[model samples]
Target chain A: MALNLFEDKGCPLDRQRFTWKELVQPPISKLDDDAFTRVRVILMNGMEMEAIRFSHGCARMNRKWQLPLAQLRIVEQHQATMINGLLGADHSILETTIAYEQVAIEVTAAVAQNEPDEYLAQVYRFGMLEDFDHLYRYSAMLDRLEGKDANNILQCYTDIVPGRPTIVEHRAPQDNLREHYDRLRAAPITKLHALTIMSSEQQTQNFYLNVAPLYADPVVRQLYTEIASIEEQHVTQYESIIDPKETWLEKWLLHEANEVYNYYSCVQQETNPRIKAIWERCLDYELGHLQVAMNMFKQYERRDPAEILPGDLPEPIKFESQREFVRRILNQEVDLRALGTQFVNKSQEGVESQQYRQHLNASGSPTDMVAAGYEWFAGTELARDGEITREKYTRGHKITH
Target chain B: MDKTTVLGKNRSGIDISPIDIKEMMALAKVTPASSSGDEQAIAQMRQEYIAGADVLGSVPLPSTLKGMASTAMEKLMGKSPEGFIDKLGCRLAFERTGVRLYDALITKCSAAPMGAHIPLDRLHEFRNEEFQHFKLVENVIRSIGADPTAQTPSADVDGVISLGLIQVLTDPRTSVAHCLEAMLTAELADNDGWRMLIMLAEKMGMEDMARDFQQALREEDEHLVSIRQWFKEMVIKDTVGT
Candidate 1:
């Protein structure tokens, strides 16, 4: 049964509590759990992080709402900790990176298909291809540098092929923006999709920035810097799709609703019962937050949240591999480029973007350098026959005292 | 922690999701790679970078005149003393890490069922030897008028290589046998490291230092055999279910 957003006032804000033990539980096994489990963990963590970020921004803008926003932000911060803490320590930075790209590709692909507006769906397809290319580049680094297969992290669920060359994903700030959806005419689902994807990309950009310097390899450090720039562009692209004219209260109501929608999706499809419980708890907590937001909306704007949110969520975002849809998009839109508020063919792309990318790649592209001549086999590239494993170095002069 | 590996929902392999693996492999076959080539291009690029690469770092030169005299004497007698001091720094860092690894092993071993046939005293002995070895290398580097504290390039690289061993040792979830396996890797490397250091010292005309390193090499040899035997016994006991 679908959760009724209006009547089901979930665990009240006062009763929502946590202990330190609850915040830092045992992480899921990287080898044993489904890749989608990590995907949900990463995405929901992004959702909670976005919630806290939005609440803080709201409090800063409106001094009257500071106390209530402070109350909500603390809970949201703990929720982010509990969700983000589910990733086990066994994941090396590069391995966790593979899972992140999987989230971007699969979640954005799912959102693209379920989107009702053709223009918005086209926007998602464009960004998804760039993230898709990042997966291939990171996978090559994992294989060549670490001698590990990305499919171990991907679990054969997501494709490890390129979508668009990341070398060209750099775009001018003007080229990155897109037309916003009309708040009144757009379906409730359109607003939810835009927020969900924007939150996810914003979190991805932040993640890459935080972990870029943690790498010891120079090329990998460069690669993170390169891919993180694209993620920043994606955040710009997706955030622009949200109606900027929407009231702060309206945006807050949608944020709470989107959190509920995402956790509900995770709960519906989560196979691991332990992780599923966390999602259910987060969902109930998000409902409580929604209730608070709804009351504030009525007091401030004198409008019903039903005007902004559907009575129920549209549907749980599908958490499975979107291989067919992704491959088709790769075939169709690999050459598509962004102009102001629109996607264009590569030839028709804005001159500003062309100069921007050319300057970015003036020295060289780390994505190209790291992934030059890279291919994916069932095992790592080392498994391929006729490949040089150790011969190229053994013939060098032996060091003798 | 469980003292053995038990079968659970281990889903990393292709076997757990047969249907999904087939679907994935089929799609992978139909989907072409973004660019067509092999790993040779990666190597060539790496070679180019290597050609243009900066050194990891420089060996710190002696500052005091007394220290300078010591370094000059060694250089006059043999090849450059910088490589020797760098390797000594590597050994010193590894032995320091070795002490910590043994401390972790002893703590976990002492926690094992209140004297459950795991030799805590032997781990203590090893831990002390590791500390002593660290001190010996420190004194050796200082004797050569080099900074004992500065992280040499070789030491930095060795730290990178031993990171996984530290992970295995410090993790509370790893069993005694698992730690022993990690210890075995450290011991085997330590033994080889001592033997090479001894030969290097002798070639550089330091017979007294070589003799001290020979004693350390013999202790490391004992560490290797004991850890290998314990690891084998633990695995066999788990396997035979006696």
Candidate 2:
């Protein structure tokens, strides 16, 4: 049965404030494997939804009612700190990073398969490979640094392989733009999907930006720098797909709805009782947020909230392994590139020449320097599938780096 | 133009660029289609969309009506909405079943006696993997512009599939071996379904999808093999009077 956020008894805005003690709650232990993935997903989803609100532009909200929105911004900042503070503990940042990539790989591939627009599907598939490669690169690091199989961390659900190599993921930002969806005509799910991914990629970028420098290992740091820049491109690529024409009120409504939907999903699927309680509480809190947004829509925009969202919500978003779904995309379009508003074959006319050099330079070589570390430690390159020899990379420059 | 110019000189310290106004006006012009007052009709239409989408192109339907409805939908929406919906529904339903099946299996295994060779941790590990698979599929469905709600057509079968596994829960005599036997049936079906999906995707010219399904196929193959081997060792070894 579906949970209705609108009908739920939610805390009023005045009552929603948290004390410092409540805000800085202890982090869920990293040892709780399931909770680890759930926490990362919730944080990532919140960040994504929050991005939509921050980027939203409202002339009407700006003209007469700037104070309330400004106040709301402060609350948003407070919530952000609270969310990030949950990860503030000295947890193994490496495993958290793995969970992030695992989420990216599975989510990106699922989006690719289910996206109604062929172009959007292609766009997602393009990024799926990059994120997939990141998972593989990080898995190698996990083995070398911690003497742990990435599978132990990854649970072997996501595959370790080369996506579009990170070396070539760097690009002149303007080249990342793709055609945008029509907010009025496009399905609401499409808008949410694009923004959700944009938010997730931006979070990944932010993560690597801060965490990369903290690492003393030069090679690992370099890999972070490489992938972080790629994430910036990913953010640009995914965000460009969102219709800039969406009104501030429209965007706000969708953002709140997304928060409610995601939290509801967590509440249903979360196995850990403690984490599930958090999801439930947050779902209620977000319902209050949605109510405020709904009132604002009615008072300012003079439209019924149901017009923006239906009387009932669509459905909860879910996270699942898209290993097969992603594999299908990898098999077909590992060679695709985004060119302005269109996705073109990598060999197409207007594609940049420098990118090809980056691809070629990195092609025969393993994407990560971990191979060298693995070789030095184990006397051979250690991979999830045992020792990596010339046979692995010699086959082709495309599938294996 | 600078931010001030586009935002109309930042009146009252609230930035409202001309570009922002321009963008908002464009959106206002293309405003979403207004909702009608017929709540029942809307709900019915939603049901129709889910049902039509779930079996679209895969099953025989009321031809004249269904074909006309689909054709009209195409002209209106610029695509066959049902086909994509059906595909997503199937993915979501299958993954959800995988999750639930694992949950039931784990519970049954943990409670049953005789940990002799079958490590409970191993069951927990597989269950965890299935949960990951569920999450991945769910994300894909959401990304593809659909909800992973069980109300969708293919998702409706989640209950049916879960019911098949309920025997492990209801019957006290059910062992990990019996659970494996039950799971083998599911694993085989999942394997075949994924294989068929790959073929369908390839035929549809979705090479990337074929690759994605192949990865899933590899995992499901492993799952099938593991379950078959376990069932023989844990259940069949004791039952056949050997």
> DockQ for all models, in order?
0.37, 0.01
What candidate 1 gets wrong by more than 4 Å, as runs, is A386-401, B1-3, B63-81, B110-117, B139-147, B200-211, B239-242
Can you tell me the CAPRI class of model 2?
A: incorrect
After aligning candidate 1 to the native by TM-score, how far in Å is the CA of B54 from where it should be?
A: 2.5
Using DockQ as the measure, which candidate wins?
Answer: 1
TM-score of chain B of 2: 0.59
C-alpha lDDT of residue A173 in model 1: 99
* Model 2 misplaced regions, further than 4 Å: A3-9, A39-64, A85-90, A353-368, A371-401, B1-242
lDDT of 2 by residue, A1-401 (tens): 77554576466666667678766666544433443344454454456446435634443456654655554555555556555555523245676787788778876776666678887887888888889777766755665665554543444355555566555565655567888998777866676678667777887888889898776445556667777777888888888898888777777777777767666766777765765676676677767777877888889889877665654554555566566677677677777765666766777625463565466446323234443322111111243235355565666666665
Question: What is the C-alpha lDDT profile of model 1 across A1-401, one tens digit per residue?
Answer: 88889978888999999999999988888988889999999999999989999998999999999998999889999999999999987889999999999999999999999999999999999999999999999999998888998988998788777678998889999999999999999998899899999999999999999998987666788889999999999999999999999999999999999998999899999999999999999989989999999999999999988888889768889999898899899899999988898888898988898899899899878888778767676678777543454444344434331
* Model 2 per-residue lDDT at A313: 53
Most lDDT-accurate candidate: 1
